[model samples]
Target: MIHQSFLDLDYCARVSGCETCRTFRRAFILEQITGRDVEFLTNPDLQSPVYAVLRIESSGDRLLLTSTPTQKPSFAATVALNHEPRHLANDPTKSGARLTTDFQELRRVVRDCHDNHECSSRYRWSRRNPTWLLEIMDNNQVRLVRGPKSLVDYVVLSYSWGDPAEMPAAEWARIKGAGTKTRNGIPVPERLNPFSAWDLPETMRDAIDITKELGFGYLWVDNVCIPKGTNWDTEASLMHEVYGNAAFTLVASSSSKATDRMIKERLAWSHRSKAVKLRGKWLHNTQMPLDKIRLESPVARRSWTLQEERLSPRVLYWTEQRWYWSCPESQVAELEELGHVRPENKSMERRSPQLFLELCRTGDIEQLHEEWLDIVEAYTPRDLVEPRDRFLAIAGLAVRFYSAKSEAGGSFISEEYLAGLWRDNFARHLAWSVAKGANSRHNLQHIAPSWSWASLPLRMETKTKHAFKPSEHFRFISVVEEKEDSEKAMTGPNFTSHDSLSRGRTMEERGRGVKVVDVEGRFRRFVSDNAKQVSWDAIEWRRGKRVGFDFGAFPGHDLFARHEADGRIIAKDAHSGEIVGQLDYVVPDEALKSPFTPYVPCGGEKEIMCLELGESAMLLLVRNPSWGHQESYRRVGVAISYENRKGFFYGCETRTVRLA
Candidate 1:
C-alpha cells in the first residue's frame, strides 16, 4: 500500500528555526513535493541559542506563514522582508532587489553564488590536482572557470583506469546510452564500422588479426567495443544487424591463461574417451531369443551373435577437436535405445559468451560458421522471419528449436522445403486471410464465423486485379460463394442495369451488403432463355409476433405485396387465430421489372408499399391511403418483388442458411 504524510505549514512558520532546523524543514518541504513523508525538528540545531522564526522560507516563492517568533528583531528582521515575495524575503542582503539585465532566475542565482564570498568560499582546492589546466579570469563577467585539464580530470574522476587503456569515444558513449556507462578512463568513439578493432587478450591477438584479415570492417567486441552507455534503441537495432552481418562471432571461454590451458589439456581429453553401451534384448532381436540360436553352427560363427548384438559401440570424438560428441548414426540410435544413461555431454541450452570468446581466441571461425549454418538449416525461414518481424523473438526461437529437433530426428524435409510448402499453401489465399487474421485480433469481443483465422497461415493471391491461378496456394472463401471456382459469379439474373453501378470502394462503405453467388446449376446462356434461379428457402422473423416467417423486417420491406396483380394477404397468425398475411401473388421469372424507381421507401411503417406483378406473386399490406404511423397495419408477411439484379450490396450475402 502507498503511504502519505501531512505538511504542518503552520507549525513550520512559527518555529523561527536556525540553519539546522531550516535545513530539516527544507527537506520536509521538498518531500511534500511528491506527497511523501519527512521529519522536522524544532531543536535540531543545539549549537545556536537564538530562537529565530523558522518557516518554509519558500513555497513556490512565497513563505508558508505560521505563528510569529519571539527572537530579538534585528534590522534584517524588521525590514518587513517576510511580507515581500519569497525571492525578495529569502535573501537578507538584497531583499526586494531587482536587476535590469536579461539574466533569468537561474542565471541570477549563478551570478549571486559566484559573486558572494560566502558561496565562493564553499568550494575547496582539489587535493588531487586537476588533470586539465586552469583557465580562470576574475573579470565581473566571469563566473565559474574550467579548462581542458579540468575536463580530463572530470573524465578521470568519473571513470577508472583499468589494466586496459582508454576506450574509444563511440564505445564509451554507447555504454552511457545503455545506462551502464562505466567510470573507466575510456574515450567514447563516434562512429562504428565493420573494420573496427579492439585490444584482444595476448593469447587471442592472432585470432583477432585473422578476423580483420577476413574483411570484417565492423566487429562487435563485447569487452571493448560495446560501450557502457549504449542506448536501448541503438542496442536493439544493432542486435539484429550484428547477429546477421558477423561472418563469425568469437566467444571468449576463459578470463585467464591458466584456465584456458586446463580446459585444453585436462578437460578436453577426459571427455573424449568416455562412451556408453546398449545391452537390451532388442539389440539381439527379441523375436529370436539368444538361447534359440545354436552357437556351434557355421552360420552362427559367421553371423552376429547375442553378445555382438548387445555390444553397442560408442567412442567420444571431442579429443580430435573441442567439446562436442561425434558418434556414428548407428551408435546414436543405440544410445537412445539404452534410455536415460546414454552418452554424456554438457548442455548447449544456454548461450555462453565465455564459450564464444574461447572459440574466437582459438581462431575457430570454421566451427562458428558451421554452428550458425546448423541453426539456420534447422529452422524454417517463415518460422524465423515472421516471428522476428512481429516482435515475437522468444516464440520464434522456440519454434526454431523445435524445428531443429525435428531435423536432428531424421526428417527428410529441410527448412527450405518447409518454407516452400508454406508459400505454396498460402500464396493465392493470403490477401483476405491475412487481413481477417489481423482483424480478428483487433476485435473488442467475440465475432462471427466463431474461429480465429490469424494463426492459420492462410496464403492470399498476389493481386485481385487478375484471374486466379491453380499455382496460387489459397484464396479467401466467402461463406456463401467460397466453393465456387470462378470470378465473382452472380446467380439468378443478369443485372444488366446494375452493370453500370460501381460496387462500393470497401466492405465498410457498402454498409449491410450482400454477395452474389452463381446459383444456376448447369446451363448455357441465351438472350431469349429464361434467367436461371436456384430454389432455396429463406427464413425470416415475423413482425409484431414473438418469431416466425415474415418479410416486413427485410431491407426494402413492401417488396412482394403491393407489386402483385392479385394483391392480397394469406397465412394464419400463431398467437391469435387470424390471417398472418403474405403469398397473395408471385412474380414469374419471365417479365423484367423496372430496375430504377425514384419511389424508394423511407423505411417507415407509413410509407406506400411496393407494387408487385406476376403469378404466385408476393403480397404487401398497403394502407387505405398511405398516411401516418398511428393509423397502421392492414397486412404483413413474406413479400417478394421483381427485380433483374442479383446482389444488393457488396460484402452482404443474399444466400439462405441451411437448416439441415
Candidate 2:
C-alpha cells in the first residue's frame, strides 16, 4: 500500500492544457517517489508573463526540462541527483533511502558504450578464453568460474587494497578451496557454496551488490579472483586483457582502503541560488568542480590503478557526489558542466597505446624509442611491493606495443630481452645513466646484469638525448650465452616470441651475461665480481698532444680520494668539467670481513676500461679480486676520459675477447 493523497487529480486535469501545469504534474510524481517536495517554476531569466518556461527545483535536487514553444511538449529532463545528508552519517546502510533515481540512465550509458564504441571491437584481447570470473550465484553466494565459451558480459572492480596486512587469511583460504572441490576424493566441476555479503569487506560487498543491480552476474576482484603464490605472476601478466575486456570497470575511487565503503551519504544543495552579492551584483560561486573531485580520489593516486584505468574500455567512477561514465565514445557526469564536450573526428588520437601503436606503424623507430623512454620515466617513480616485480608489472604494456607492431607487418629486431633493455637497439639502449634523485646504490639481489639499467635499484635516464642516433664507430662483438633456468621459469609468466606465446621464455629465467663490443676496433671490457662490482680503472692519462703520463698513485687510496673530491667519481669531463654521466655503487656490508676498506686498496691489482660516449669518454675503475675459487670484479667509480690535442683516443689494434 502507498500514499497518493498528496496529488490533486481533479486540479491537475483542469489545467492539463497548460505545458507548465503538465510539468508541475510530473514534478509532483517525482516528489511522491522521492519523498521530497518538488516545485515547478519559470526560468529566472525568462521575463515573459504569458508562456514563460517552468523550472523544477527541490532542496537538494534539480531537473532541468529542455522544452520550447516550437518543440514538442515532452517531459525530457536532465537530472542532477546528489546523496542525501542522512547517507553520510556514520552508518551509511542505516538510511533506508534508495541509492539513486538515475539507475536507468546509468544502464543506458553502459549499453550504448558496449554496442557503439569502436574500442570494443578493436581491443578483443579480453574475448579470449581460459579467463576467470567471480559469478554471483543465488542466495548471496559467489563462485569462481572459468570460460572458454562465447563472449560473456562481466564487470571488473578497481580498488586499492590499502595495507596488505589487513587481508584476512581465512577469506583467501575459502576462495582458494572454492576454485576446486572434491566429493568422495573425486574432483567435480560444481559451483561452490555461496557466501553471504556480510562475509566480504565493505568495498567488495558494495561492488558485488552493484554488479547484481546492473544485471551483471559475474564480477572480477583481484584479491579473491586471482590465485596466490606462483600463480600471482601468471595472472598479473593478463591484467591488460582482464581489465580491457570487462563490460564495465567499477572504480571505487573514493575508498582509501578495501574496508572503506564506496557509496556514502553527503549533504546536497541547490547550486542555482548559491550566488552571493559581491560589489552589489550577484556572483555565483563555482561549486567544487567535477574533475578536481575525480583526480583527487584515493585510487587515482595509486600506481597499479594507472594501468587498470587506461586499459579498461568502459569505466564507471563511483564518487561521493555523483556517478561518472567514461568510455571510448564520451565521458559524462550527472552534472551538465561535468559532461564531456564531444571532440572532433580525431578522438582516436586521444586513445593511449593506440597513439603509441600508430607511431610504431609509421616505422619511426626514433619516435618509438623516445616514447619508450617517456614511459620509463613516468613509471619509475611508482611504488612496488616487491622490487623484483619491476619488470613484470610493465611487461603487459610492452606486449601490447609489440602486438600492434606485428599487426602492422613490422618485424621484431630481436626476440631476446636483456633485463629491461632489448638487444635490437643494444648500442643506443645501453647508453643509460642513473637518473637524478634516484637511489645511488645497487640492490644486493641479482635482478639484472650489471650493464643493464634494471641492475641498480635507482631510476635511470638515457645518456644520449637522441635514442636512434647512429654510432658508426662502435660495433657489437658478442654477448655471453646464458640458458634459461627452468626452476625460476615456473614462478612467473614466460616472455616468449611474439608469434608464439607458448615458445617464449620469461626474462626473469633468462641466463645472466654481459654484452661485449668494440669501439673503433679497440676492445673495451667491463669486469665485475658476481655482477655486483662492475667498474673500470683509469690506467693512463694525457693532457694535450703530449705522450701518455702514468700516475704512480694509480689504484691507490690517495688518488681515489682526490678524484672523488673533485667530483670526477661519476661522469664529469676532466677537460670541460661538465657532468655528463652517472654511476651506482654498493658498499659491502660492514658486518662481513673484507680485505679492502672504502676506496682503500688491498694486495689485489686494479684495472680500468674506457667507455666512449658521443664526443666524450668515461674512465671506469674496475677491481677483480680473487675470493675463493671465483674470479670477480667490482666497479668503484668513474671519471671523464679527456681527449688529446690530436684525437679522442690513441690508435689501438682491435681484438676479440670474452667478458664476464
Candidate 3:
C-alpha cells in the first residue's frame, strides 16, 4: 500500500536530518522546483515567494518523496488532503494505471489546437521551413540542425533574459560561444551539447523538455537560433513570419526571466490519481482547470511578446498557477469545461484582419481608431531593450491592419504612414496626449518626427468624444526623412508614401514651404457672419491667469474641454461624473490666418488652428507662456462656433508657411 502525507513538515525535517541539513534541503528543493538559485531565495526584495508544500509518497517496501516549490504550500496541502485516495480491491479487468502525468494537459491542448478545424484552419502556415532548429535527442542532448527537410513542426519559445547585472560571466561566455563555429564562415552545424544541461537557463531546459514531450522534432529559441550582431537586424525583421508560422508559441508567462520556472509548487498527492468505483467500472479523477491561470502574466507585459502573442495561431501559456491554451478559435484553461468561454476569447477572435475589414465596411472608423489606441496603450508601457524597436515591435499588427484595409478597398484608409501615424486621418489622429504622471524621455534616439506620438517615449491616451474634422482644403504637401543619406523613409520601414508629387526634402525645407491662413479675416467678420451680434454675455476671460471657461455658460460653444496631459474631459452625462477623451492642441500651418483673428490675446505668442471634429468645427489655442520660448507651448483652451463654421472659411486665402 502506498501512503502520502502532504505539507508534512515533520517528515521533511526527519528525512532532512539536522536543522542545517533541513534548511539546505528546503532551499535545494525550492531551487529545483522554481529554478531559482540560493541568491534569488536570499533576495528578500524579490516579488515571488520561496515557500511551498512538501509531499511525501511512501509504500511498505519503498519510500518516495517529491516536492516542487512551484506550488503554493498552503493550497497544495488543502487540495491534497481534500482529494485523499480511496483503496479498492484489485480486479483483472480494471487496472488502476495510466500514462505519465507530466504535461498531460499540455499534450491535450496541443492536440486539440492541431486537430480542431475551427482552430487549425485560421493559421496561415508557410511552405518554406526555417534554416535551423535546436534538436533535442532522446539522450537529452541538444544540437543545432541545418535544414531538417523532414520536419513539418516546430515550437517557438517566448521568455525573458534576466537582468544583465545578475547574469554570470560564465553563462554569457557560453551564450556568446553558442554559434562560434558558424561565425568563422564555416557551414558546419553547431552543437550545444558541450555545455552541460544544468548550465542551460531554466527556461531553455523547460522549453526543450516541452518540445520533446509535445512530439515535436525541433524547437526555435531566438537567443540560440539567431546569431547576434548585424545579422540580428535582418532576423528581427522576420519575427512576424517566424512566430506566425510556428506550430504554436510557448509563453513562459509567470517567469519574468529565464531562471524563473513556469510551473508552481504543488503537493504530489494533488497529481496522484484518485480511483473510485463508479457503477461497474473504476474511474480516475484529478484536478486540472484553466481557472488557476492568469491572462496578464509577467511575460504578457513584455513589449516583444505582444506581437508574438497576436501573430501565433496557437499559444500555450504556462503561468505560475495554471496552464492556458489560446488559439484563434478558442482560449481556455485546462480544466475549463468545453462551452465555457472568456471575454478574452471573444477579443482574440476579433483580432483577425477580417474584423478590421468589417469595421471599414460599416465606416466605423472611430471604433478602429479606438482599437489602435488600445494597442498603443498596451504596447507603450512594456520594456524594450532598444527603444528604436518601438515601431518595429508593433509593425506586424500594422501590416495586418494595412492588409485588411487593402481588402476593404483602400480608398477609405490612408496610404501614407507618417512615422507611426496615418496620413488620411492625420489631424484627428494627432489628438493624442501624454499619460498623466508620465514623463517623456529626451534621449530616445529620435526615431520619429516630433509631431508623431512615437516621437515621445511616454504612455499616450486618445480622445473618445472629441473628433478632429477632416479638411479637404488642407493638403499634405510632403513629408521628408530627417536623415539625409539614409534610404529608409520617415514613414515606417514597412510603409511608403504613394504620392510622388510630395518631395522628400529636409525638415527645414519642409517648414519653409508650407503655410496657413485664417479665412474668416478678422474676429468681427467671424462674429457678424455666424450670429447677429457677438455674444459677450457668455464669454469671460482673465487677463494673466491660466485660461478657464465654463462649457455650460457658453451654450453654442462647440469646443469641448479636457485635461491636456491625459486628454480626459469631465463627462456631460450628469449621472456619471466620469472623465473621458484625450485632447492635444494642434498648431496649423503659419500661412493660414489665425482662426482667433482679432480676438488674439495679448502678452504671449498665440497661435490658432481650426479644430475639426466629426462634422463639427472649433478653434484651438496654443500659447507660448513666455516670450522667446522656441519649443515650449501650453494648450490654453478651445472654442466652438454655432453652425457649420466651414462656411466662414470658404474661399479662405492660402499661404505658404511652416508647421512645427
By lDDT, who's the top model here?
A: 2
Candidate 3 lDDT, 272-361, residue by residue in tens: 233433224332322333332222455644677776766676777765434567665566554453332324576543434234323433
Candidate 1 runs further than 4 Å off = 1-247, 251-265, 270-473, 476-660
In candidate 2, how many Å is residue 357 off? 6.4
Give one digit per residue, the lDDT tens place, for model 1 in 1-660.
000111232133235322222322332232111110111222233112222232333431122222223543210111112222223122211322121211133233323323542311221112232211111112211111212222121100001111112455554444334221234433233222121112223323323432233332222333333445443223322232222222222222111120111012221111111111122101101111111122211112211111111111111111111211111111111111211222255453112212322232233433432333222222211121122122122122222222333334333222111111111122222111111111112221111111111122212111111122221111222223244522232231221122211110111111111222111111111111221111112333446757544432333322222223322222221222212222212333343254311121212223323211111122233332232333322222222221222111123222221100
Rank the candidate models, highest lDDT first.
2, 3, 1
Q: Provide the lDDT at 71 for model 2.
A: 59
Span of ten consecutive residues with least summed lDDT in model 2:
31-40
Model 1: lDDT to the true structure: 0.22
Cα-based RMSD of the predictions, in order? 33.4, 15.6, 12.8
lDDT of 2: 0.47
Q: Rate the local accuracy (lDDT) of all candidates.
A: 0.22, 0.47, 0.46
Question: How accurate locally is residue 350 in candidate 1, as Cα lDDT from 0 to 100?
Answer: 13
Off by over 4 Å in 3: 1-102, 147-151, 165-182, 185-199, 267-295, 338-370, 407-414, 441-445, 458-477, 482-660
Candidate 1: C-alpha RMSD to true structure equals: 33.4
